[model samples]
Target: MNRRQFLCTTGAFAGWSGGVACQARAEAYTVDRALVLVDLNGGNDGLNTVIPIGDPLYRALRPTLAVPHDQVLPLDERTGLHPSLGPLLGAWRGQELAIVQGVGHDAGNRSHFRSRQIWDTASDTHEYRDDTWLAHASLPAASFVASCTDAARSIAQHEAAVVRIALHGFDTHENQALRHAALLGQLAQGLMMLRARLIASDDWHRTLVMTNSDFGRSARENAVGGTDHGAAAAHFLMGGNVRGGLWGAAPRLNALDTGDGLPVSLDFRQLHATACAHLGVAPPSSVERFAPLPLLRV
Candidate 1:
């Protein structure tokens, strides 16, 4: 359509309009990105994984549990990885990792169930609600995952990027690392499902950002027991769309400072922003509002 006729056809229809231009720009881009969010249930100690060896404060915080500087898998002078996260580090080396550190909401609640709900709901600290409560009123009943009602219930109210999976076994502590790893696997699978959906939809012009995290709500105990509430956990993102290659500005190992028993560097919302940007959705006004990330590959 010519410019004059286009302008006369209402701004909405005018392909030249500002809003239309942005949307078209995003749509026109051929990046079919999908995401898999692995919400790690326990705050996995960020200082250890994305170590802050440069900071002496970190060394003083957890002398016993601290990952020594030499043992860390170095990303740079500022950060490193936990020995346990070997597989992920491989992804990092291959430029398939984007470690957005210091992720947590403001006035954080240390409660496992509460903090987790906040992460799920994207709500604020003062806004208390029943974890058992579900937003069935907002979801399409057909979309519900009958097998994992509680898991699906938490996020179904929000706009999902075509697919969703409900996870339930993250709270188990008997096999801590095993359970977390299993959860990660499931998250990866979920993203694969979303990827299939995106491809099937033929919206091959998008991008995806798969992400998931755990709350450090473990009740601290012995070597083979429980873990308590702490801070600094890990979230993994894969797929071809991610900037990857270990992107984030946090300290290194042996430099950790568990001041409030959590990493003080990264704010969870910033990671949320990164995710929203990856998902191709506008960032929410506040962390409480569910923001659509722009991390999709189209």
Candidate 2:
């Protein structure tokens, strides 16, 4: 049979009815899950977006910048959304989004550069000397969209996806910010396309984005000005199966004194555990060691 026919026949098992050969090719792969991680680059503040407006201390500390308790989009009594993150509100409203608050590794470094590196490498301060961070496994099989020529190389050494694209620069749009966001959206779409290309299965799972900086960073720093790193930034799980709602405590700005930044409720180790589990790796710390957070359940 031709490739198209082969894909069509196989896609039937994944519940897809299509003449597209790619669909059949996709069906051939038994493992069809994906994980898309994005870095916020600079440390994104969690406190601003997932605000704990109920806490008077929160308002007290950021008297000038605090999101008005009334103005914030209330997810619950304590948690609220920054106005700019309206797009995420839908996910929250649907209960598919799980916002694990207080998720920073304990004793996090406040320095933007160092903290970001630690997060990207997923290494503890102690293990920093051992280079274990560089030993991260490559993105799970067929789980990457090569965005750069160096993408393959980076993944080869560090075991991560560094997606590349062919788009050229030098846009003259009067609305630079809008244009930039548009380009990024397009880039995400392209990456999604690449992801789809890598899949050869009918039962394709959803995609997710993980990063150190929270969504609130772009709004606060780029739009507002300087930033102070906070704990427990917002993460996104985009797929058909996401639970779609707020999960985790709102950022406790008042509790900043407890650490260099707001304390994390969802342990980063737990997130690692969820990632491993999503890759179909079973638990009890046999394959990998990480704390189990509720991220997977949602």
Candidate 3:
């Protein structure tokens, strides 16, 4: 098509008057890009994982549980990460890790079964849905996986658009100090290896890795050096397309909920919306109302 012919055919594409080039960018999924969901099966203790090292309340609330100041991987003056997550520092430094803090629903439940249902379906506390949130978004269903390496391979090979990997044993009701550290260590190692493989295969930019859980553990340490079921946990989003750094406020340790849980600062649905849009797809009808976070590169 010559200039005049092209202008006549596509001039109105973006309300163009033919003085300059007009382009149309469709809002649809890029079939080649993959979304991987990592489920931290049991409730993760957000406080210990993403420590507020500068907060005096953190030490007071978890005298036996708080990660020591020096040992915490410093992210800022007020925030730090668990030493076990050191492997993720490269992603952090490379601006591939975006941390979403205090994420939960206002009507969040303490029961693991009920809360998991809410997250899985992306429904209101009083609502119920048999299908998953991704199904509502009209995306492909996730492929179940036992290994991050396997999931990374699939993404690299273009085997799946969506994959779910579950890591169990986050419920730390006893001996949490040791147990939680080990679990975080495993998570960091798996993600590091998975990221390395993706980077090697040239799939890192087209792949997004997100982590989730049933809920968060309580802010206050228990008598047995552990935490109970709580709310408002932290989550991570990693990919070359990500705009890394902290996205939400660190929970106020001084002002916990009645259940001794951190206050829900950012709605989890917002995350769903952001993820959907990040993939160049519109969010599901229910999730459309929530504002998408600016966590991804344009």
Q: Number of the top candidate by TM-score?
A: 3
- Give the 10-residue window scoring lowest on summed lDDT in candidate 2: 130-139
Q: Using lDDT, rank the candidates from best to worst.
A: 3, 1, 2
Q: State the TM-score for model 1.
A: 0.55
lDDT of 3 by residue, 1-298 (tens): 2223322322233212211121221112224556777888889999999988888999989889999888999999989999999999999999999999999988669988989888877788998877566631111212222277777766665444555677889999888999999899989998988899899999998888888899998999999989999999999999999999998988898888898999999988888887676655655666878998888887
Candidate lDDT values, in order: 0.45, 0.45, 0.78
Candidate 3: give the clashing pairs: none
* Off by more than 4 A, model 3: 1-30, 135-146
The TM-score between candidate 3 and the true structure equals: 0.86
- Residue 276, model 3: lDDT of 72
Misplaced by over 4 Å in model 2 are 1-31, 129-205, 214-225, 230-234, 258-260, 282-287
Instruction: Tell me the spans in candidate 1 whose CA falls farther than 4 Å from its real position.
Output: 1-31, 56-59, 68-70, 128-210, 214-227, 232-234, 245-259, 263-266, 283-298
TM-score of each: 0.55, 0.59, 0.86
Decoy 2 TM-score against native:
0.59
| RMSD versus native structure for model 1 | 10.5
Q: After superposition, how far is residue 228 of candidate 3 from its true place, in Å?
A: 0.2
**Of candidates 3 and 1, the better by TM-score:** 3
